[model samples]
Target: MSTAIASPRAFKADAAFLRGLGRAFAGALIFALPMLMTMEMWQLGFYMDPLRLALLLALTVPTLVGLSRFGGLRPTARLRDDVADALVVLLVAALAAAVTLYIFGILTPGMSAREIIGKIVLQTVPGSFGAMLARSQLGGEPEGEREKDPPTYWGELFLMGAGALFLSFNMAPTEEMVLIAYKMSAWQSAALALVSLGLMHAFVYTLNFRGGSARPDHIPAWSLFARFTLVGYAIVLGVSLFSLWVFGRTDGDSLKEILSASIVLGFPGAIGAASARLLL
Candidate 1:
């Protein structure tokens, strides 16, 4: 009798899981499509340093796990569940990359195993982020899942970092990042940095975007700027540097060159960080 009662429940659970997988795949493809199709990305795939790539994949796991805690496709109530979702999101990312690349003629059986694996691994970081965010962006969660509690200050910082990483990662492989850096004068770079910081602050506290946190009346504006905007931009800068390094953009570059490129990437990264609550 118990088995009979459990059969329908099991079927329902399986169905829901399958649906979650579908959402994950959709998210992965949508988020990773640009990188998958870019020629530079393809070249970097086979040529990128193995150690750096490995570190990227390793870091991605924790990032995905953290994202799962806040916005997993399933309503996770425990650390184990978050980990499981991270793994599942990775699987979804891989499958999405493999299928899309195959259809695009980028992945062929004739290609070396190393090449194929490298391409997929590189794409997986962004893809997994998309999968983890599918619930929030695509809007299908299993029944009875409550909204996530408000994030603490650190939690907010993590979200900003994740957002910054996602946006910066998308652009890091492109040649334009370096070209723009080269074209700019030192004064121009300084102006751009100030502009980035100003826009980020505006987006977070001044612009009044729907999901933006309302600054309490008693909390002075400068305090909020120092506490969130400055810190978030710092995180964005770190993410930008890491993304550039992952793509070998910093190989043999001088400190001035590296900082210039980082500031260029940090414009979008800062925007991503400021709007994380809206996006992720």
Candidate 2:
């Protein structure tokens, strides 16, 4: 009787885990589907340097840990829980990418081992992000709990960087990013930069959005701009450049060309940075 009861309890726990994993997989697919469909992404995966890919993947560990702290696919109370969740999400992402790519004919047995690993590694970037975001989208933390543990200044900045990276990754591999840059004159690019800054400020400080309200009367406008808006834009720019480099879009590009592309990408990236809190 004891053995039979124990078996049912174990099965129940296993079922719950499977359910959570399924939710995480779905969340990852929602965010990564576009990148998976991009032809440039597929091509770059096979041709990009292995060392660079490894370095980028290594960096994802900390990024995942930070996201897990803020909003993981499941609630975690301990450091070990956070680390375990991150590793599990990464495994799910890799499995999701491999299976989906295989189904789409993007991964085949004929492909060399290096090529296979490269493709999955590149795809895992967005996949892992989606996994981390799963909790936010699929429901894990209560609103009261979230309010009880708000993010720190640096934590907020990390959220901005993650958001910027996601939005920029969606656009960075496209030829249109470069083509739009080519069409813009220097003055237009400058105007764009100003516009990006203005929008980020307005969204996060002045305007009321789903997650943001009008600034408190005590907080000065200049202070808000300096603290959040300026810093967020800087994060956007950094994330934009990093995305371009990761996508192999900056190879052999002139300084002018690179700047233009970064500016164009930075526009959406800034919005992402400003609105990250709302999403997560």
Candidate 3:
């Protein structure tokens, strides 16, 4: 009788795990589909500097840890649980990337092991992020439960960075980002800087977006500007620079050129930072 009782319980647990895995794949596909289809991404996967790719993958771990703490696909109560969730999601992302790339004929028996691994690793970055973001994007858990575990101030900032990175990744690989930056005059760059800052502040604090709880009326203007807006823009700029560097757009560029590119990319990055709460 006890064995019979345990069997049903075990079966139910197995079913739940499978369901979560399915959600993970769906989320990975939803977030990574565009890059999967992009030809530049496929080429970059094989040729991007291995050291840079490794560093980027290293950075992903902490990002995943932060996302797990606040908005993981599964509720995690302990540090180990969070780590486990991240690893599981990473595995799911790797599998999904391999299957999708193979189906699209991007990966084949003709490729060497190093080339195959690089392709999968490059794709896994976005796929794993999508897996981590599955809970917020694809829906899981109750609102009350989520609210009970509200992200800390640092976690909020981290989420802004993640969202900025995700939104900018698609554009970072395109030649147009560099072309646009090269064409802009210094004054135009300055104007863009102002616009980016203003839009980020407005979108986060003033626009009253659905997911954001920031209230200008309740918070002092000085505090709002200093605390959220400035900090958010800082995150955007950081993400912009990092994205450019990862995509090789910063190669051979002087300091002035790099700064110009960052400022140009900062427009989209700032918007992403501001709308992180809604997107993530």
Candidate whose TM-score is highest: 1
Error (Å) of candidate 2 at residue 128 is: 0.9
Clashing pairs for model 3 are: none
Q: Please write out the lDDT profile of model 3 over residues 1-89, one tens digit for every residue.
A: 45755787878966877888888888888888998998877888888898988998888888888788877777767988888878888
- Report, for every candidate in turn, its global Cα lDDT versus the true structure: 0.88, 0.84, 0.84
> What are the runs in model 3 whose C-alpha is more than 4 Å off?
1-10, 216-218
Tens-place lDDT per residue, model 1, 142-200, is 42355688889999999999989878888999999999999999999999999999999
Weakest 10 consecutive residues of candidate 1 by summed lDDT: 139-148
TM-score versus the correct structure, for each prediction:
0.95, 0.92, 0.92
Q: Which ten residues in a row have the lowest lDDT in candidate 3?
A: 140-149
lDDT of 3: 0.84
Please identify which of the two predictions, 1 or 3, would achieve the higher TM-score against the true structure.
1
Q: After superposition, how far is residue 108 of candidate 1 from its true place, in Å?
A: 2.5
Worst 10 residues of 2 by lDDT: 139-148
Off by over 4 Å in 2: 1-14, 146-148
In terms of lDDT, model 1 sits at 0.88
| Clash number for each model | 0, 0, 0
Q: Evaluated with lDDT, which candidate comes out highest?
A: 1
Over 1-280, each residue of candidate 2 has an lDDT whose tens digit, in order, gives: 5565569777896687688788789878988999898888888888987877887899888888888898886667887888888888888898889889999999987899888999999888789889888877786557556552767779888988987887887898888898899999999999999999999888887678877746879988898889888988988998888878877788899999998899999999988888887776
Off by over 4 Å in 1: 1-5, 141-145
